[model samples]
Target chain A: MKPIELTEAQVKSRRSRNIAIALICVGLVVMFYLITIVKLGPSILNRAL
Target chain B: MSVINDHDPVTEIYISSAMPGDFFALLKPRVMSLVVFTALVGMMAAPGEIDPVLGVIAILCIAIGAGASGALNMWYDADIDAVMSRTKSRPIPSGAISKSEALGFGLILSAFSVAILGLAVNWFAAGLLAFTIFFYAVIYSMWLKRATPQNIVIGGAAGAFPPMIGWAVVTGGVSLESVILFAIIFIWTPPHFWALALFKSDDYKLAEIPMLPIVAGEASTKKQILAYSILLAPLGVAPWLLGFASIAYGVIATVFGAAFLWFAWRVYKMDEADRKMLPAKKMFGFSILYLFVLYAALLVESLLPKLLNLIGIA
Candidate 1:
């Protein structure tokens, strides 16, 4: 099989998309943490034996 | 992913590399946005509480499942999409993505979304998501799309499932409220699609897809559009009458529902001499607004008291 090369536009598009996905994932993590805190209140920090 | 047979020279030559953007495009983000919005409304309208984190997860699963359906649709419709001008630039037709790649992406996402929803949320919602993906990809895309003029009417069920799934995520089962939401979209779809078919008949003809306008005569299509619109107008206000929504929503639904009927009526009476089918175009555009505004009103009705209480105003 011959090796396939990505065009310049394809490379740029892929890079930008990866960046966007990364950003969205980070945002979701932070939002999840905050929502847990809001929902659980003081219990979030209360790790009992 | 089912690999396309590499017998065609064009496929071998043009499809050198696919970007992540192409895979994303296969997901049809615009359609996914609408699904997310409606599903979020469904969750809000449900009587029970969903933990915010779980709510987010449910929404994510629904969105991913919607994207899976879109990708699979693109995979299956690639041949017709290549011929239709409106779809000619889609990722698969444009050679930005391969059919096999899209099929794989859709399948993986479908499994992941369903599995995660089942594990993290309720299996009922997960089951609905799985069925929705299958219904759209297999039932709508593979079977109904080319088989009959009433394709949109049946295929519309796939689009109508998100809200029901959302409600199930909160309530752990389907309810009258969710079914009403489902009915609103299911009934609204025929007129919405037929209006577009009026103007895009040539595209359908070229693609050989038997859309209502292409299969039925234009006058017949127009009559059916008007009939569905009449049914839709009354159904739009069913929630308010059934006490699922407030009176304010009833008034808004009634006014917008009347406007929707007016547009459909104009389409019905439009002259063939009016080649642009402006009435049909107007009806199509307004139909989208009609669904969006009605759902937004319902969402506001559901969320307002909670929001006010959160802010100490209620």
Candidate 2:
């Protein structure tokens, strides 16, 4: 059987995609987290008194 | 500054290789946003008033501190990120930004954030922000990450400090309210991250990262997810019970907490072949909503009492 060798471009492309996804996940979590922070902080100010 | 700058060949090359996208990626804007928001909540929930200027300064310093951590994490994780399918295209890995540049960016920002927070806000707030940065970049990245699968479990606290620091920024000291906020995030971190791990186990395995799903089989990871969800319900309501919120908010918290546990239960009950793994996906989606709604409700509750007082009803 012949060995299936990957080109450098293929390997690099595959790796870059993973990073994009990771960055994306990080972004999603942060977006909600911030929305909560901004949304809640002022409300807390009014209610906690 | 010119829109036509892209017409120049030099500018074209720069844009392709070193875009603002690349630099913003280093800030880990996603991570920074969370730090900022939680800190904002802390500031609002704290018992005293903060000067608007000081509050803004504190948030900015924390943002920079978080960005600094992201840069440093990129510097260290560049190697692993280069290998994994989820992180390979990052600037360093993609040959866009050099490793030294990322490290220098991280270190400079770290010092800048800590110094600014100390000088502009209180030293205590600055000190806490500084530690949060160190915990994320040094403790979590340099040590716990590769050394243990429990990395996020312990390291998650680094991200949880923003509210505490924010509370300090307003009140000039740590309080129970901020600590409860921290606990909510800390508990949520495991299950939230574990959901990602459940779906992306192959990526972590490829990167040689010891995320729970990679080290333990799916069944064990699922069990742990249920366990965390079970603990998360009551913890979610801690802020309300401690006099940090009101009865209306308390009721909302209970409903939201129950819904989150239900989603976890669905995920737990799924058989391996359940409809292309919809259960995990549902759990993941609801998990995001669970945190957002939880915080949103807190914010709403915070304001409701004031609104009532203003209307001469409270």
Candidate 3:
């Protein structure tokens, strides 16, 4: 019947967890970029024709 | 929400106020870490090269799939989990999340992981991910877990498939080397869990899960643990013998495998009156380290050559 309110500790824990997930997602994006560079090299941007 | 008669199911509560941590807990992060590590080692060990992006994508899918299975397992085992002391504080049992919500979360992640993997990588790896999820969630959790003492023995396959799937991501198919990796984990699992079961027999008894120690008794369980450890010893070194790993890895595997057996032997020789189950507890702790160190060795074996080549040392 009423909106559920999170305790202060619960809110703090939730914030930290969301931040951790966000950081991991960012790390994955950075890794993908580095991997693309290592894999493709200078030839990546070259015209095939 | 409404209350029901004692015989009827609890009225379905639609409270969706679950915290972020609760949802993450549903993913079983500890188990997902092992799946990710093994799958990474598998991909690295494969002979051919894979696009770095594709490799990362595959690993992500594998991790998510593992988490999906974990959530589903929690959903199905919630009742027993509530009864078991070790699992009584889990997200569902602790009321951090509801069963229906967990089921929905697991199914969505399962489908998402498989579909993304298929589209971004090869279909074979995707299929393996799907099967692994299904095996753990359906075959293992829903059926085998409650049906017999051999539940973990067969259900362990669900855990073992990650490395093979990792190999498939790179090689596009299975091979002797990948199968060997699968076998090592497969063989390692029984002794590992049975050691835990030895100490946690009361939990299994209370939950009525029919674990080997409960069904076949402690002495029999200890003997089986030793037998499996003996089998695991040689199998751990198979990658080195098969020429994929270096002599150094072979030596490490041999030493770890031997130590694993020594622990198993200790567990077997432990007295029944030894209610502390010190040997079984020791074996259980060491088993986690054993797998971690062995996989770390394999990962080094896969990476060392490249590192040496980069430095012009080999």
State the DockQ of every prediction.
Answer: 0.20, 0.03, 0.14
Q: Write the per-residue lDDT of candidate 3 for residues B107-200, one digit (tens) a residue.
A: 9989988987887778999999999999999999999999999999999999999999999999889999999999999998999999999999
Candidate 1: misplaced stretches above 4 Å? A1-49, B1-16
DockQ of 2: 0.03
Instruction: Write model 1 residue lDDT over B203-288, tens digit each, in one string.
Output: 99999999988788899999999999999998999999999999999999999999999999999999978889999999999999
DockQ of candidate 1 is 0.20
Alpha-carbon interface RMSD for all candidates, in angstroms: 7.1, 15.7, 8.3
Against the reference, the lDDT scores of all candidates come to 0.90, 0.79, 0.90
Q: What share of the true interface contacts does each candidate keep?
A: 0.13, 0.00, 0.07
Better of 1 and 2 by DockQ: 1
Residue B235 lDDT, candidate 1, scale 0-100: 96
Per-residue lDDT of candidate 3, residues A15-48 (tens digit): 7766877987897577557656755778789867
The candidates, ranked best first by lDDT, are: 1, 3, 2
State the displacement of the C-alpha of residue B171, model 2, in Å, after optimal TM-score superposition: 1.2
lDDT per residue, candidate 2, B58-104, as tens digits?
Answer: 78888988998999999999989998877887788998777887898
